[model samples]
Target: MPDFSFDRLRRHPDVEAENLFAVDASDRLILDEAAADLAAAGPGEVVVLEDHYGALTLGAAALHGARGIRTHQDGLSGEQALARNAAESGLAEAYRSLPLGEELLAGARVVLLQLPRSLSALDELADAVRRFASPHVRVFAGGRIKHMTIAMNEVLGRHFGELQVSPARQKSRVLIASAPLPVTDAPAWPRVARHDDLAPGLSLTVCAHGAAFAGTTIDIGTRFLLEFLDRMKPDAGSAIDLGCGTGVLAAALARRRPGLRLIATDQSAAAVASARATMEANGVTDRVRVVRDDALGSRPDASAELIVLNPPFHIGSSVHAGIALKLFEDAARVLRPGGELWTVWNTHLGYRPALTRIVGPTHQVARNAKFTVTVSTR
Candidate 1:
């Protein structure tokens, strides 16, 4: 058996800091417990979900000799890191990335799951497993004990008949669930909700995939940013909703100023799908374009006159600013000279300095007890 080590893992193109890590004890625990079954499985029988890097997938392939593993990661950065780590470890052929749907779970007998913190995300995963995975599939869902909750067990219970929880080891635990139950109800994903008071004379229909932040409801930060929509230059030709979660900013912009061409982009596949659904529900599909990308990586530089952002302050449970700063740089690159970048962030983050340094001159547009909205010129 080959020795699997986390030292080989990397978070390339993502903000890497000393406090952050690519792999943790939970990955090792899951791989160790499932090593026997995985080693006995044939090609394509194993599936991995939400792998932070390539720890579980590559460990199963390299150390346990599992073959033809399929995997799904919601974040583009996670997918990119997995590929890079696999290549560096010479395990590139061990697994393949697929969307979180039937294709990824079809016929999978053993699923290695890194438990998501969101119950809605867990519901979506459980639904797919019950509907698509093999009848006897065993799901090994594990996470840090601090992040695990009783609600997660309930979510899995809805899909699997037997649930066995492992005693905590190294501050991590695994839930072993088997015996798929029949679920005839339609999936609860892409949830739709109406917000009547988001703005005056405006009712925004928000569509959210299971993993999307602030699902089907507007966040206070965004609601604050909405206050300044009318303040943007009237003649700005085009705009972008950088890091658009559910296309709230983009849809609102389109609705407020009818003829504006708005593009919404996010790295999460779920976010892109949700944003598109939101646009259609709001009847702005023709004006708002949704794309899954890593911080405007797919968009041309200096092509837009205005951009809006509500950047995420965390990365995989760690309160890190790498993701937020990356978005700021992206916004700076995408905005034309003298273009405006509107942003909302937590006041404690003190992102104003970064905005000034990265985007150009920055000024406070609005602030409340907890949030601050700023406008930066490119």
Candidate 2:
């Protein structure tokens, strides 16, 4: 093994804190378990999925002499972190980033995956591998033991004929699967569903790719926030759906105000794809533009008149307020003076003070049993 250093990895462009880390034991264990396959594989044979940083891809390249790695990361932040780490480590040429499709999986012989928490995501990835990757491909999927469940094995088994469980090391474990099953059915991802009861006389068709948050269903926080949609700045010519997952809010807004220009943006590639599909399903494609961005990073400062948000309270599995606070600061920077930021969050998060400090003059809009909706004006 080469003397490669995982310690050099950092979660830049994502939330960084004492508890959050770019690399984890699961990453190390995945690399360790897949070392022989990576070393024996030919060029363009290794693929990494949902790598939190460049750890797995870089580790395979630097430590095992693997080359031509193709990787897919759902979060734009993760992709950015991996790119930065790859460049800094001088392994930028070893791998290329691609979407989760046939181009990324075709002819792949070895796949190292940091198992996603969502079974739907794993199912989609496994199905893609079965349908597109080489028949001899071996998938080494690992995650923290606490997050891994028996259902993950069941999900992978649906696509692969063989499944092997590795012994736990450092509270992490890897599941080895091979022998891709024949795929006869059409791809099941980007699932669509109709919600007629979001509001009276308001029906929404939500579409979600496998990795999208809430997955074709509306979360309580967003549902609470939507209650006050009519009360939003009525005269505002344009509006933004910050962190718009599935574009539910943006579609509703576009329907409510036919003349208002709308933008729906999220960092997750899956979310962006799903939101675009949702917008199209609702016949709002021309009125609402979907973008994959990191917390309105592409928006100009003081450019937005109204923004609707249901910011995530957790970064990865670790519950942290940093991600929400980062969005708050970005929303503040993007909102013009007197612009409104309507937000809904868990009652326990207590984001009012932060909103007041970051945006300005935060006022409670509504409160349900578990959620609190607030409108902050800049």
Candidate 3:
């Protein structure tokens, strides 16, 4: 049996909390179920997708001696954590990160996957595999049974002819699929949606990739934040949409203040892509710049005149505040003196105290039953 030690694993570079962990039962189940296929595959033939913090990648390399493993992770934190974990575990060069397309999936055999919760993400992955992978490739997709749905099977079935469900173990189950089916055409993504009710004559085009938060629609927190757009300093030369999911905030800012240069940044590759598309769709591509980065780490200290955020309350699936706090700290570092950080968060998170300590003096902008919007002056 391979050494599957959770005690030795860590979520370094990803948000960590008392209750959050790097590996899960599903990770082990996927690896265990795909052991035979993984062992038989030659170098560069095995592909791993969404391997949280190197568990699937490192485990495959270290335990099964699987080499030249090509892997893809949507989040920057997860990618960084995987690198750190690989180095710490003496498997630094075992796997390389690649985009989810022809290059990553143009393989000879087996794939170990951690099924994404988003059905759209699943559709994208399945489409890519069917379009790129070898005809005989077998995919072992596993997840917690509680998180699985019939839709996942249907999504896989659309691309693969054969599907087999593995017996549940440790509350996890793996879906094995093979025989790639040909598709006449690939589906269009970065789907667009229009928000006409935000403001009179202010119909906005929102775009989103499958993995983007809230998809193409504006979430309540963001919609609430947008209500106060008129309150932002008009003359501010540059503004940042920190943790921008689909560039909605940045696009709105650009649309409202054509003179302002807006930076839209998020850690998720999918989010960044969606944000860029949103900017383009809304005719703000020239004014809004979309980037994939860890919080505001890519910006220079004291560089931004204004930063707006609708921070996430969770790290992966866990309801933890570490991620929001980290973003708050980054916003603090990036905002200039006299600049402002406008934030919207779940009211229960009670981020005002942390905002005061991290950014500067804070004042409540708006609050309702669910969310609180606060502005912190630096």
Candidate 4:
């Protein structure tokens, strides 16, 4: 452990609160477990994946003397936070951000990963490491103990020949994997699934990359929200899908209303990729534009006529309303006067009041035992 201060790290450009943090025990444990390998590796031979904020990448660079590091973060917010932290720490030259592809992993001898909660995401990451990285690459993946499961080891085992479990420390643990297995088949990401039952005479070809939320399946909340597709302002010419995952809602809207223009946007790289693929698969690419954005951050204020959202309630793993509220505020900013913001949420969250205060007068459109769909005027 060098003198680098994890305490100095901040999760700016992300929803921040007393409970949400930029670094965690798992980050420190991962760096400590890989310190020897990181120090031994040459410059440009280190790669960091799924680093939430700058902990793993910056720690490896500033603390372990690793340089020319390649990093990939699924979330745009995390990527921005890393850049800000790197500049503030005067280590901006140590690492570069890249996509989750061969360029990021090529010839890499050491990899530090912050384990994702999705098994499909882990599988895709492990497969890429084995397929693209150096044969001798050593992967150190860490996560909180409560979020770790035996299934994760199995996912890694499918891509690596050896797996070593480190002793848990401070309720965190790491998995060391080496001996990359030969990949024979095509990459298994951007999975495609078709649904004909969503609505009568309406079928969706949903595509999802591994890290995309809800994978290729339509979540119950989104499905519930889609029930009101006909009820959305019929004369609206354009719409934005805020936090769009897999472009399910966007594709559905495009299919139902052939003349309407659609924009699907999300912060996650995987989600943006998945949404683009989905739009293309559904033959809606001409009418739908998919973008990687942080909650309509790139959209002009008072430009959108209608917006659809299924805002996430969690910031990272903790249940919080800050993220949802932030989305609401952004939606309010983007929607034109008298425009509509239709959203779906968990019934228990009781977001109607927040929606009313942030967007405009809100009214529930529909509610089931589990989810509630609402419409707010802007």
Give one digit per residue, the lDDT tens place, for model 3 in 1-378. 244455678887777777888899999999899999988899999999888888899889988889999999999889998888887778878989987788999964888889988898888888888888888899999999988999999999998999999999999999999998986885667689988888544668998888888998789998889888878866699999999998888998899888899899999988999999889888998888888898987789989999999999877666888999999999999999999999999998899999999999999988999999999999
Q: What is the TM-score of each candidate against the true structure?
A: 0.97, 0.98, 0.96, 0.98
> What is the Cα-based TM-score of model 2?
0.98
Candidate 3: where is the Cα deviation over 4 Å? 1-6
lDDT of 2 by residue, 1-378 (tens): 343589989999998989999999999999999988988999999999999988999999998899999999999999999999998888888999999999999999999999999999899999999999999999999999999999999999999999999999999999999999988899998999999888766889999999999999998888887778789998899999999989999999999889899999999999999999999999999999999998889999999999999999878898999999999999999999999999999999899999999999999988989999999999
What lDDT tens digits, residue by residue, belong to model 1 across residues 251-369?
Answer: 99999999799999998878888999999999999998898888888888899999998999989898889999999998999899999999999999999999999999999988999
The list of candidate 1 runs beyond 4 A from truth reads 1-4
When 1 and 4 are scored with lDDT, the better candidate is 4
Model 2 score (lDDT):
0.94
Cα deviation in Å at residue 323, candidate 4? Answer: 0.7
Error of 1 at 114 (Å): 0.6
User: Which pairs, if any, clash in model 4?
Assistant: none
For each candidate, what is the lDDT?
0.90, 0.94, 0.88, 0.94
| 1 against 4, candidate with superior TM-score | 4
* Cα lDDT for residue 36, candidate 3: 93
- Comparing candidate 1 with candidate 2, which one achieves the higher lDDT? 2
Greater TM-score among 1 and 3 belongs to 1
